[model samples]
Target: MRINLRGLNRTKKTLADGTVKIFWYAWKGGPPLSGQPGEPEFIASYNAAVARKVITPAGVLLSILQGFQASSDWDDLADRTRRDYVKLIKVIEKDFGDMPLSALADQRARGEFMEWRDKRAKSSRRQADYGWQVLARILSWAQGRGLIARNPCEKGGRLYRGTRADNVWTDDDEASFLARAPAHLHLPLLIGLWTGQRQGDILALTWMQYDGAHIRLRQSKTGRRVVIKVGAPLKAALDPVRQKEGQILLNSDGAAWTPDGFRSSWRKACAASGVVGVTFNDLRGTAVTRLALSGCEVPEIATITGHSMRDVNAILDAHYLHRDQRLGDSAITKLENRTKSPN
Candidate 1:
């Protein structure tokens, strides 16, 4: 495609703050071979040939989308994250209109372009964060393609500092919620509570991982096999949920529920049981806490919870530390009694 430069001039428009506005005009459909500008003919702008012809911003984005879809880098990314990129491109197109990455970079000069992103209305903070991540990725990719010299997002002010929701569940809360959960969800609930396995892993559990006396399953997040002896309470919970089929946890339709579905059901169960602020992930924290309270060593709890020693201790500090106060108090009382009796 060739650009038409007739009647268009490349000029530096001074801003109110005396900063130069850098701009050059070229044909939208193609590069300009020859055309006389109406003004500022003395200024010479460099004409460069691109490896791939960029006709429009939307065209470049479509190329990037196709490129990512066919590339190995797109593999192994979480399905949701991958979808976010596609969704984000559509969002940018809708909000800012399709423009070349180079042109977009130029427009990003004063950071007002990003202000539009912040002004967008979102249903949740998570959606807002996803938008930020999408823009960040696009800018990073643009930089790597040499389409832009630097990512304006690399300046870091445009990104949102999202708050992390809580992931702490108590034993009583877990018990209450599980009691109210549907009969079919027993195994899924046990896996969530006992192993702290992610919803995906729990839904993926097979009978081979469950031995008569212990459970051995590889964690998806870390790719580490964790083995834990079946405690009586957990065994009881699992007994009713065990199946001879492919997956230990299957929805009513005999298919595994997605994480989103599991989270929705979990929230409902929590509400029914009158347990507030307990997410499915809190079960993992509860498992770690229960192990620490039972006097399991730090390393042992880490094996069961798939936690680093530091994280295990942090959980212990938060949930199990105060529970040990009674033990300390009992020891002090015994010491006082012995001194009084000897006197």
Candidate 2:
């Protein structure tokens, strides 16, 4: 029997482990309806939800959150970012949903929010910071609408201080990984190191984006179109496996890789190869490092990597250039040549 209920929102999400989980909500941004559809408890909950005069009371945190979700600001976020924010919003709703919106305006509310963040940081600092950021964004949006006198989440500093500045892969690490990893993983590794593109962008890359000499695509995050003159190494790796259509990078099954699936495989391959302390993301910075070492100027490197001029400079200065002995050696050689020149 097919069951249809008006005002019910059903969402299906696939877990990292490939399990399908179905969620039922009374309405968009409304309370979740418990139990499976067609069950007595589910029907009862649905009835009660619809009967209620108001799902969320005004001047409460939950109401503000719902408002924010409906706003143009929320709709403007990138698809992946919006999905991530939805998870954080659920956490915020569970923790502080019923609290009066007025409490957020109190100067002391910032301390309380920080305390909540501190408890979460004990388990995962990066996750805690992400949650704080999302909550702050929501409060800021609410403040703009004049629902709150102030945003208490402002200036809540990060708990995760980990840096990947020095985490670029070395030549030996690259060799070991390629030797151990499956053949399908090779192209992705090469593309990251060569093009300096993010994992997501590379995974989403299609055959159409590549010409014989150049690969062109607009970065999903920044919307910047980058036309990379395919490096010798990447081009060599790409040629034999080049397809007439579909995504460039695929898994062992010859299908496009999901973010989670690729991450899991990449981690196992790294562990098997004895590679540690670096990630696929570090390839971006490594590309910048390699470019600088090859005598490419900042603007030129930025053009290839799709990073802004300032970002390229910061990556070189704060992360790679100062620490690289080769750059230091080149600087000394330049000084010696200048000193030896005829006056």
- Against the hidden reference, what TM-scores do the models get? 0.62, 0.84
lDDT values for all models: 0.58, 0.83
* Window of ten residues with lowest summed lDDT in model 2: 11-20
Candidate 2, position 330, lDDT: 88
lDDT of 1 by residue, 1-343 (tens): 4544344334343322223443333422222222243333312321421222343344444444334433434433434455556667567656654444455456454265556555663454455556766666766765686756766655444344542224456557667766786776666666676775555566666666777677777665455677877777778877776766566666768777776777787677677788886566666776776666577899998887678899888767755455555447867898999989955
RMSD of each: 15.6, 5.3
* lDDT string, candidate 2, 1-343, tens digits: 7667787776664422223566677777555566898998998877876764266566789887766665656544544676788788889988998899879878889999999999999999999999999999999888887888899998888899987767988999899989988888888899999999888788888887888799988776776788999989899999888888788999999888988899999999889899999899899999999998998999999999899999999999888778888877888999999999989
Off by over 4 Å in 1: 1-62, 83-89, 103-113, 121-123, 141-148, 155-167, 213-218, 221-229, 239-241, 294-301, 307-343
Q: Highest TM-score among the candidates is held by which one? A: 2
Error of 2 at 334 (Å): 1.5
